[model samples]
Target: MFDDVIQEDVLLEMKYVYDYVKIETAFPKYATKKALQKYSSPTLLFAAENDVFFPSKLIVPRSEQIFSNLTKTVILQNSSHMQNNANINKILTEIEYFFSN
Candidate 1:
């Protein structure tokens, strides 16, 4: 029964409300301690210094505590959500090392 959906109406009313609820719901539901504990095997977690989604210092410690075989964590000071620049290079280096020897 979804019809007559105007672009502006969706964008202005439904999308804003949906986005707000989604943002509020996502955090508490997703990143739980038990959820983190499920990760097994050698894991490499890369967190950016400027990331809004995941804070490096906070998440890194949890990862270390959770994963028994967590190989390494690379915190890129000059990086954001997307890994770019020398930090990305360093991450690649770490990944290479972890896989190699």
Candidate 2:
């Protein structure tokens, strides 16, 4: 899908793409600990145990401390960034439970 979009767009400039990539690379610098610490709303974080991009060990603790309101963190075992059908169902069940209570 992404490849098709890139291929079809004749006017897509390389400079614009480079700039976007540069901004994305620098996102963590602006989206800092202090920024996360300001969150006060209830949050449910589903962390994939095997996800390299957002590791559960690092994110869970920081999230717990950051959110002033009730924060629930579920570490889905044997799951990657893109969850399987079973894991997706599990997440839906968790969301339903979270909302009901």
Return the top candidate by lDDT: 2
- The TM-scores, one per candidate, come to 0.57, 0.63
For residues 1-101, could you state the per-residue lDDT of candidate 1 as single tens digits?
A: 12223456545776677767655444654455576666666788887766767778777887777677777777877556544445557877888898898
Residue 25 lDDT in candidate 2: 50
Clashes of each: 0, 0
Clashing pairs in 2: none
Instruction: List ranges where model 2 is wrong by over 4 Å.
Output: 1-38
Which candidate ranks first by TM-score, i.e. highest? 2
TM-score of 2: 0.63
* Candidate 2: Cα lDDT at 92: 100
Error of 1 at 26 (Å): 3.2
| Candidate 1 collision pairs | none
